[model samples]
Target: MPDVTTSVRRRAFLLWAVAALAYAVDLGTKLAVVAKLEGRTTVSVLGDWLVLRVQRNPGAAFGMGAATTIVFTLVATAVVVVVIRYSRRLASAPWAVAFGLLLGGALGNLTDRVFRAPGDFQGAVVDFIAVRDFSVMNLADWAITGGCALALLLSFRSSPMTGTAGASDAGAPGAREA
Candidate 1:
């Protein structure tokens, strides 16, 4: 018997640690951008498709929402909570990694909201990754989007989160074939 009370909280800790790291990296880079670029500079990564264009965002994803950084901050907090809650239900390492990335992104943006510029809790997020004529974004945003995509793809596997029938539940008349 592997008699141990170590618990499986390592997964949860990993999720949070990844979040912290993402947040730190984002914040540090944004600070550096503000110091060096001073909110007006561009470094082309792939011609015009991907560029490191520094900018500040005071809204939700893709610069859709606006001005209400406080509201966005609240939403970020709620998202972090939900991510943590759902992460505990993950049974696959891939799923965990995906969720961790999403959580990390959220935390990163949230940190900016809570710490940088304007007011105490009324600060905007720093976005630097630019794509042609589209809105500027940062690494955290990419991680969040990518992780969510991965999680959705993994949902069709063996998770109870997906209502679709898997291998064991295949061809049960009422269920569709796997």
Candidate 2:
């Protein structure tokens, strides 16, 4: 069996690699959308079910909090810092991947918030990929959402109090043995 340190290191490497890939894809898609659809109208990709519509959003996901660009920027910065700080302790592959996705998504949006348009540290994020009856989002948004979902699933599957692989009923206050 591999040692704990080796396992952790391997997970950390996976986290960084995945983060880099996610960030790259997010940025690339945003740039391509902006360049191609700057002045064009929405182009339906799936017969109105999905469309390509370029938009600059100075807000949170789904275009909420339009007036809180700076605040979100600060929050993203904090998230990146916290993720990096905690990544050193990540021993699980799934958790590492989750954190990586989150970090990449945050950084992808943070780049636009810092360098896009309007002004520095207050720029709008380039958002495209509109879903009918849903919201217009980008790759970063998907990554973040996916990461959150995975994290939630992992949390629900593990022991809550002991951080173990399975739930324990042995030490319950009032429990019956099977």
Candidate 3:
């Protein structure tokens, strides 16, 4: 069996560190954009395929949840706390990374919502990396999406059938599918 105590620490630290790194990058880029562009400049790349267009988001993925920053922030904070508290339950690196990416993205956006806006607790998230006809996103957002995708891939790597003594335990009353 894996060392549950050590695994717990590994998961928590890794997740928080990943999140912190992501938040730093996200905040730094947004600061640069705000200082240099102030939402007035656009740098085109790939012939209109991509552009650095500054935008503020107060919502969820793809610009959803604009009306609920307070609620969302609280939920995000709760998620971080829960994940950190339950890190021991994490069984793999992919899960650890996924949790970290999500935590970092949430905290990154939450920082904006808490301190960069028209009012307290109503700040807007900085989103760049505009895609024509699609929505604009930032690094934090990408990290969360990418991390979740990677986690999903990892989950597939060890389905229940491939689990420890899976076949031997398959006949058990509590056996589960992968």
- What lDDT score belongs to each candidate, Candidate 1 first? 0.71, 0.84, 0.73
TM-score of each prediction: 0.76, 0.88, 0.78
lDDT of 1: 0.71
Q: Write the per-residue lDDT of candidate 1 for residues 1-178, one digit (tens) a residue.
A: 3212222354456666666777677667877877887556578799989888777788876776777778988987898898877655444456666778888888888888887777677678888878887768887887788878887787666354322222244544444444
The lDDT-based order of candidates, best leading, equals 2, 3, 1
> Whose lDDT is higher: candidate 2's or candidate 3's?
2
Backbone clash pairs in model 2 (N, Cα, C under 3 Å; residues 3+ apart or in different chains), count: 0
Better of 1 and 2 by lDDT: 2
- Worst 10-residue lDDT window for candidate 1 reads 1-10
The segments of candidate 3 whose C-alpha lies over 4 angstroms from its true place after superposition are 1-4, 158-178
Per-residue lDDT tens digits for candidate 3, residues 10-40, read 6667777887888798789888988887648
Output the better candidate (1/3) by lDDT: 3
- The local lDDT score (0 to 100) that residue 144 gets in candidate 1 is 84
* All candidates: CA RMSD (Å): 4.9, 4.2, 4.0
> What TM-score would candidate 2 get against the native?
0.88
Cα deviation at 133, candidate 1, in Å, is 3.6
lDDT of 2 by residue, 39-88 (tens): 79999899999999998999987789999899999999998998898776
Q: In model 2, what lDDT does residue 151 have?
A: 84
Q: Is candidate 1 or candidate 3 better by TM-score?
A: 3
